[model samples]
Target: MTLSNDTLSELPADVARPGYDRAALTPGIVHIGCGNFHRAHQAVYLDDLFNLGEGHDWALMGAGVRPGDAKMRDAVLAQDGLYSVIELDPAAKSARVIGSMVGFAEVASGNAPLIAAMSQPSVRIVSLTVTEGGYYIDPKTGTFSPTHPDIQADAANPDHPETAFGAIIAALKARRASGVPPFTVMCCDNVPHNGHVTRDAVCGLAELSDPELSAWIKTNVAFPNSMVDRITPATGPRERALAQSFGIEDAAPVTCEPFRQWVMEDNFPAGRPALEKVGVTFTDAVDRFETMKIRILNGGHAIIAYAAGLRDIEYAHEAMADDQIRAYLDKIETTEILPIVPPVPDTDLNDYKQLILSRFSNPEVADTIRRLCHDGSNRQPKFIITSISDCLAQGRDCTGLILESALWCRYCYGTSETGAEIAPNDPNWDRLVAQSKLAKERPAAWLEMSEIYGDLAENAEVVAKFTALLNDVWARGSHSVIADYLTG
Candidate 1:
């Protein structure tokens, strides 16, 4: 049966659906970027909370700002804001429909309705899962880009805004004027200091035209930092067919490994759902956890993705199956990456490393290398380059990271070494291709992207190794570069 409220009872008896009355639920949270990850992670947590019959007022209202998000809105709304989450493990697989989301905004009509709904007194939390690049953050400065066209448009006309953060600004403005308590802005992206960055983007953009309003926001609003992890792959025909096998004709089903982790700062002045009740770690020190996860797991994914993609590897597990790739992942984390990571409370670094590598090696998850290699322009700065920066600052060797960067440069050239035509994926795809092609002969040319590399291009030691590796990659191929590095 097609997955919807009407067909809920028709679903297989084994597959779990919401036991609580959907009509009894009310909206208290609005989530931007209603993607598969959000469904498999945050929405699942809330589904568990709802099943426990505690968070009846905290039902989620899914939202989006981009035009492409309209499709997501259509899919979820058709299912009555209910979707199936398929957890894949090698030994066993399970399918269940999660019903944490009670409603989704009319995305085609724009942000007025979204902002108006968010401004209601019933809504107390506005969260985001927009990717690292969606925030309009400057990679070089680590501050919100004041010149971002969407931000400028929002600043010029605050009421009729375009971006998600802009819509948030408008909602906050309305709530402040009406004496409704402001919603806590929670960022769930993989960016470092994600809460602070979200705050900076919203408040910095707010300050441009309304200094007093921005000051009010700075004093009153709470943007909680969070670390979220799950390997939810893009929904395709295979996932849909799997859903059909389970007697669920879900239009948009999410498939992931049976592993999820969320560590968050406990800073919700406006009240939040009891996510910690469902295995979410609430910590006073978010930086420690975020640093550990971002550097090791997120950074490690970037390392694997770029290195693997250059050799035309398809799935992440296939990449991890390679001996040299696994060795490179281990060596880079132990030496270059983990050295700069701070001590996370109750987390054994080595054990965590094993857990991450095992997750990467899960064949059932079927995470695509293309997905990981998609946004190198934004991700390289946050997930990869930041660790390299710390390694250089702490007087550690970043040779492996430099190779990863060179691999990124090579990957961006729009062709695998196998001569496979790489489709354009990144927003800065043109510049990456042009620079990468230039860097083939002039190996230093890739680092000249000051926006992406910042001063790392100018670091004599790092630059020398980066140049040498790029030259090696162009001459020796990615496999030979990894082999030589391991042998050396």
Candidate 2:
């Protein structure tokens, strides 16, 4: 049976469906970027809350600004906004159909429909999962880049904006003009201070056209910082097959590890669901939790990704199974990354590190190495470079951290150790490839990209170590260099 509102009762006996009345559901949240991660994480949380027969008015209305989002909107609306979440663990697997999303806004040329949907008085909250790179942050200064072409275009034509932040600003303008209260802007991305980052983007874009409106947003809007975690891989044939195995054909079935977490600041002035009743942690010190997770888990992914990518490993679990790759990850986190991370409340950092390792080792998720390694230009600055900066500030060892940077540079050369081509993975692939070629002769050339390395390039000690490690990798191969680092 095809998965839809009509076929919900026809699903397998074990597969869980919504217990509440879908017809009575109301939209309280307008979420942008309805990708795999949002479907698996936030949507699942709302699904659980609705199952408890509460927050029926807090249903999700998905919206997006990208052209690809039109495809996702079609796939989701075809099944009446119904899809399956398949949690995979080595011990067991289970499927649940999520119905928290009541509708998807039409994807149009000027985002008129999205702006109209968000301007509704009922949409008390606007959430986003637009990925780390989508925020238009300047890598060197860690501030919103108002000069970006997309931001410029939106500022020039605020009435018919093209970007998500632009549409948000347009909606807020409508709400303010028509005597409606402003909605809370919640960011669910993995970046540190994600809420603050979102506020910067939204208000920064607003400042371009209307400084008064920008001040109003800064004063009235509440952007709650959040940390979201779930090992949901990109949906493909395998995941669709898994859904079919459950006797429900779902076009966009999300397959993920059984573990999930969301640590958020309780700053929704417009109100929010009682998500704490459903395992979401609302805390004052969300930054501490954010730091622990980003450095250890996301940073750990970067730690293992380049080496595995160089060696032509397919899945993240397969890379973890490699003794050398696993050992490198363990050593880097213990010595370089964990030492600088601040104390999270009621949590042991060591135990958290172990949990991250276990999650990476879960064979059932089948998370891709390519996915982990993609977009190094954006991710390296957030995940790996921050830890290196902290270690440098405290006068600690940065040998492993610099080596990780070298591994990324080597990977950008576009070839695996096995002589296979590594297709372009980053948005700035051409520039990275050009720099990688130059760094082959002079390793400092890679660090010279001030946009990425910033003042870190001025440190003689870091420069020398990076040069040596990168040279060793190009000369003797990644395996040999890794072995030397392990023994040295």
Candidate 3:
């Protein structure tokens, strides 16, 4: 008999579902943003801990920052708070049941339940996967954007706040008043020194409301920086079909690449589950890992995605499969980019490069160029800025990175090579498009916006290189430009 949806209740007798008495599991952690990356990364780790008979007292309570998250709430609830995760690799495929999350804290309705959950004495960790933009930070300045309407609303009402920063501060105040220990604020976003950024945003918002409370937060809260990696694509019909095939009635099952890594600073104040037993690397400095991953992997992603998108390549693997584009990526990383990266213990950059290539070439994942290309304004600063800075410092040729930036600027123009109308993805898409057009007319126009490129735009040599490459890209298109750079 084929595995049926009804058979899911009892884990097929043969397959042990990591038995943990549900009655003993209580919600001890509150997570914001119940997205795919969270499901495939942190939740998976927590599930592993629970399966190992550890973290039995800890369960996840999902919370959303936006009303659009209501759909995810409904989906997780339909599956008995259970979800399927498929890990795909070129060599193998593995599937697992993740049951770390127990309930949802509806944030759109009101902050009352969410605040209460955070205010729980038993809740020791308040984790986040609120993407880069959710930080409400100024992309140019790298500071909390208080003028943002969300931040403004949060600043206006210090006590009952809506933004994540507000919620955290309000919850912290409740803990302070009630004589409860504060939960460690763990940030799982991809930003550099995420803990520090989280600290700045939270305390920045808090300072606006009450200076004393902000000072208290600085003294008490522990923001641990983390480096999390898992290539999980957005769910589509194929993913839905995969879940259905497994006889699982999952409304929002997540499909991810087999590879995963999470490195964090070991600094939880109240208490934390011994997650190290389940493959979490707790270290003093996550800077090396963060820099290595962001510069090579993420930086390469930006380089290839924009270049490929300009050539009308649909998916990432498809772009990687193209010999010309693949060679171009290899040349850029090895020659211009890799030398600047500080060495990590036991990490062979060459081997890692090979692994990245294989992962990108995996046809099954179908990671889209457009998905990777979204939010260039926020992403480029982290992914590309450092490499560009390194090159400028050493007086090395940044011909390739400059070309990559030009491609990104061209991509923001919102029209594809085949004249297809590209939809806007970034919060600043309109601004990016208007500036890019003006820049194309006067090659340094966009870069001159000191806020984005800083002084890099005014440097005659850098502007000349970028302008030349931008002109070449417009003349011969993406592949040819890449081929020319690789050979000459």
Q: What TM-score, to 2 decimals, does candidate 1 have?
A: 0.98
In terms of lDDT, the poorest run of 10 residues in model 3 is 1-10
Whole-model Cα lDDT of every candidate shown, in order: 0.89, 0.94, 0.83
Better of 1 and 3 by TM-score: 1
Worst 10 residues of 1 by lDDT: 102-111
True-structure lDDT of candidate 3: 0.83
Stretches of candidate 3 exceeding 4 Å from the true structure? 1-7, 10-16
| TM-scores for all predictions | 0.98, 0.99, 0.96
| Model 1 agreement with the true structure over 133-227: per-residue lDDT tens digits | 88888777877899988788888988778888888888999998888999999999988899999999999999988899899999999999998
lDDT of 2 by residue, 206-238 (tens): 999999999999999999999999989999999
Ranked candidates, highest lDDT first: 2, 1, 3
Candidate 2: minimum summed lDDT over ten consecutive residues — where?
Answer: 479-488
Q: How far off is residue 188 in model 3, in Å?
A: 0.4
Taking all chains together, the TM-score of candidate 2 against the true structure is 0.99
Using lDDT, give the best candidate's number: 2
Model 1, position 145, has a per-residue lDDT of 95
Backbone clash pairs for candidate 1 read none
RMSD of 3: 2.1
Q: Is candidate 2 or candidate 3 better by TM-score?
A: 2
lDDT of 3 at 5: 35
